[model samples]
Target: MSKKNRQIVLASRPQGWVQESNFRLVETDVPALKDGEVLVKNIYLSLDPYMRGRMNATKSYASSVEIGQVMVGGTVGKVEASKNPQFREGDAVLGYFGWQEYGISDGKGLQKLPESKDIPLSTYLGVLGMPGLTAWVGLIEICQPKPGETVVVSAASGAVGSVVGQLAKAHDCCVVGIAGGPQKCNYIVQELGFDQAVDHRAGNLQEDLEKATPNGIDIDFENVGGEVMDTILGRLNTFARIALCGMVSQYNETQPAQFRNFGAMIASRVKMQGFLVGDYQHLWPQAQEELTSLLQAGKLKYRESIAHGVENAPKAFIGMLKGENFGKQLVKLSEE
Candidate 1:
């Protein structure tokens, strides 16, 4: 076993957008495990836009990350040593192990992964994990998109949005995606099979969106806010539904999110609801089963952007906030 455990800790809170100076990487000796505890060597550290909200001085749905504490994140790791009866040395598990190379757990939230030859373990941190579940809840349950209806997704190339678009397609809905760049727009349409994709950065957002959805949007799986949300709101058909997921566009903003189409809700009779994945814990097992089945049937496609080491997590996280990542962003800590 290694003598030291490396960690990325929060050095300070961000005022607006996250900066690398807000994080610091340090090493400390791994302590001996006590009874009923297991030591996990982390393999991958999940990077997400929500972390930016956690860096704030104010609290929203969850508590904020305090200075000098290990930055919080989801991780997939191998059990290095176990004094717990339920786990063995080589077992793979998923847990909220934070931004550290190793974690000690008492078997509370840790889930032992089942043996699978088809899917990669890294996917458990992204597609088959929170983002996947988020997409499912938003598109399948909240949006309730019907066949032949137009379902438009924002931040359409990111982890949650990509999965949302694909799932809508699987349901036979006319899926359109909104992404940042031409390359990402191409990936969402060409590779992911979205019916149409509009590049938000192209300076023709309204024109392109109008061209894409001739009958107007029936369901809006919203991720990015700001101008994107404002535009999508304008195109909502009467009785349209919107699954308000994350608003990464306003996550790091100094000001609160503003929507210009508040009147559209009345004019279009749109039903918009904001949700958290944890709110529907009861359906998780069903979601996992169906998502895995979708994977086996080759109906779902996913991508991951990996940063090399734990030390690079801050940079990667900051990049993800700026829309620099193409898919699910993660930090590689150790080999499987």
Candidate 2:
């Protein structure tokens, strides 16, 4: 193992849109493992839109990252050294190790990841991981889409949304995706097998969504909560289920959001519920098992937008907030 560990820390808070200057990359010595501790060399660090919210001073599902602290994130790494009886050298593990080349843990939150040629390790941070779990919990557990139901997902080509769309499609539902561009929209429809896809950037969102879903939407998997959400809410069928995931569209905005169709919740009897994956940790293993089977059977697909180094993680994160990333935005910290 290298004696030095390079880490990306939050340098400052963002005033509005996140800037690269908000982060700083610094190198430090790798601390020796204490009793019952393991040293993990991070390979892939997930760059998510929620990390932008963590940069703020206010609180959310998790605590905010203070300035000078390593930015918080999910990581997949290999155990380089171990003092714990449960972990051995070269064992792959997943944990909240943040943006660093090295992480030390005593097996608190760490879970052993599978070592297999068939499934890539980076998947522990994406599809077969948190985003995939989010999709499962939101779609199957929360929304509970029935066959022949019309399901619409915002940020449809993104990591979590993509998984949600595919899961809905597998359930024999009519899946309509709302993405940002023609390319993403095309991929959502053709590549992911979504029934219909609407390009949210084309400026006629209402018309596009209306045309795509002739029947009123029954299951709304919301990822981008802004005008797209407003348009979807307006067309919700009675007793419609809405799984409120991340609101990527307003993550960078400094001001409070004013909802135009929030009343649609009552008027259309929409069941809009916001959720965090952390709330259902007990079900993650079950979710992963189902996802793995689907992936092996060639029924599910996942995409990754990778940044090559830890130093570039900030740029990748900022780009993700601006909707520049394609799928799961990840920083390739080390090679397998």
Candidate 3:
């Protein structure tokens, strides 16, 4: 009998919050490889906040996922069978295999990963992959921190935000990370080495952020936008830079975020720029090289919350959006 491939598909567009009923898990036979095609058995599937935006019917930077389409995502997998000269069986590669146990690739958009036991294949989905690049581009390219400058990172305990805070510290800046709970806040400060951490759920965002940035924020790596952003904006020093990476706080909201500190941008002359990782693809190689170096030197720290099966991807994704994840969130579909 042929092996069955378990896959998750979009059943409905989310209304306000994403429910498990929004996704449908279906099974199909593992596909046979055609000429110039490779059979990829997915190992890890990434769950990110940006995916919540794609669930909407209204299109944003990327097109919305149509109902019944395989949910969009990045995956690290192994070549199970290959009929292509460019790829061989057992080769580990990275591709957009989405939320599936297996996928078919034509070798057109697949990136073969270098064999390294030092760095786990899973890190390629987190600190050394898109999230890391997003952090590097947002902080290095957009924020442009200088030594002694105060850099504040919202969602600081998350994959991208954690890297942002660490990179800021490496550049001799006073780094402050804003996360949801005390555990996350403590982890960022005590473990991840952020200079300070503010709990956004403590119901004292304004006062806590004010205390954390006594000198005022010179650079804001804005991730959780809503009130966290408003608090950061209100504390911006003259000519501060704001690297607007994400607004995970409002991704599932039916109503738009109410900005209470827009005037602060005018008063402080802040330079706020929003960026997407796709637009800066050219810089990915540079980000990968530098982040790997940081990791090798023990200067970078990372964590992950892994959901065991592909069937749990939707639940894991929903938890990540709610800030329940510690760092990078991934679904482990199969063993490496």
Candidate 4:
């Protein structure tokens, strides 16, 4: 019998919170590669909050995942067989191969990863990948963080937020991170070296955020929207910049979040820009270079919550959307 290829397909669109039933796993025969095609055995799958938005049948930067379609995701995989000269067997490649145990690529969008024992292949899916670029672009390009500014990043323990906090600190700014629980908050401050951390789940977000930003927030790297964002809005310094990234808090909400302090934006002359990382694709290589330097210098830290097997992708992805993942959420489909 042909090797079984396991895949996760979108079974249905989410209503409020995503259920496991929304995804359906199916098995199929691994197809033979055609000329100019490369067959990749997927190793790692990235689970990000943005995937939640894609599950909805709404217009966005990218097209929505249709029912019976393979769930969209970033994957790091090794080429098991290749008919394309651009890639060879044993070459590790990265691409939007979605949630599958195996993927066939024509080498059009598949990027061969440089051999590096120093950097784990998984890191390419996290700090050195989209999340890292998101952080770099938002802070350095949009926010233009300056020394002595007070930068507050919401969801500060996750992949993007964590990097934003660290990058802000590197620029000589005092960074205050807002995360869900005490453990995440402590990790940001203690391990990630943020100036302070505010636990948003403490039932006193406004008070705690005020306490953390005595100088007022000069920049807000917002990842979680709703009350956290509203609280940050209320604390903005004059001419503060807000890089409105993902709104994980409101992603699964049936009703939109009410922002009571939105008027503060106008009063404070804040400049808020909602951006997609794909828009800054040209800067990714440069961002990776700088991020890699920081990693080598021990100025940057990263963490991951990995789920084993492609079968668990739905569960892991749901957890990531709920802010249960400590850092970059990923699924290990196969060993490198």
What TM-score does model 2 achieve against the real structure?
0.97
Which residue pairs does candidate 2 place in steric collision? none
Give the distance in Å from residue 49's predicted Cα in candidate 1 to where it truly belongs: 1.3
- Quote the lDDT for 75 in model 3: 98
Best prediction by lDDT: 4
Model 1 C-alpha lDDT per residue in residues 217-262, reported as the tens digit of each score: 9999989888999999999999999998888888878787777877
Write the candidate numbers in order of decreasing TM-score.
4, 3, 1, 2
- Residue-level lDDT tens digits of model 2 in 217-311: 99999888878888998889989999999888888776776678789899888888899988988888788888999888888888899999899
The CA lDDT of each predicted structure is: 0.91, 0.90, 0.91, 0.92
lDDT of 2 at 255: 71
Model 2 residue 218 CA deviation (Å) reads 0.7
Candidate 3 lDDT by residue in tens digits, 11-115: 998889999999999999986678999999999999988888989999699999999999999999999999999999999999998999999988988999988
Segments of candidate 1 deviating more than 4 angstroms: none
> Which residue pairs clash within candidate 3?
none
lDDT of 3: 0.91
Each candidate's root-mean-square deviation in Å?
1.1, 1.3, 0.9, 0.8
Residue-wise C-alpha lDDT for candidate 4, range 88-131, written one tens digit per residue: 99998998999999999899989989888788898889899989
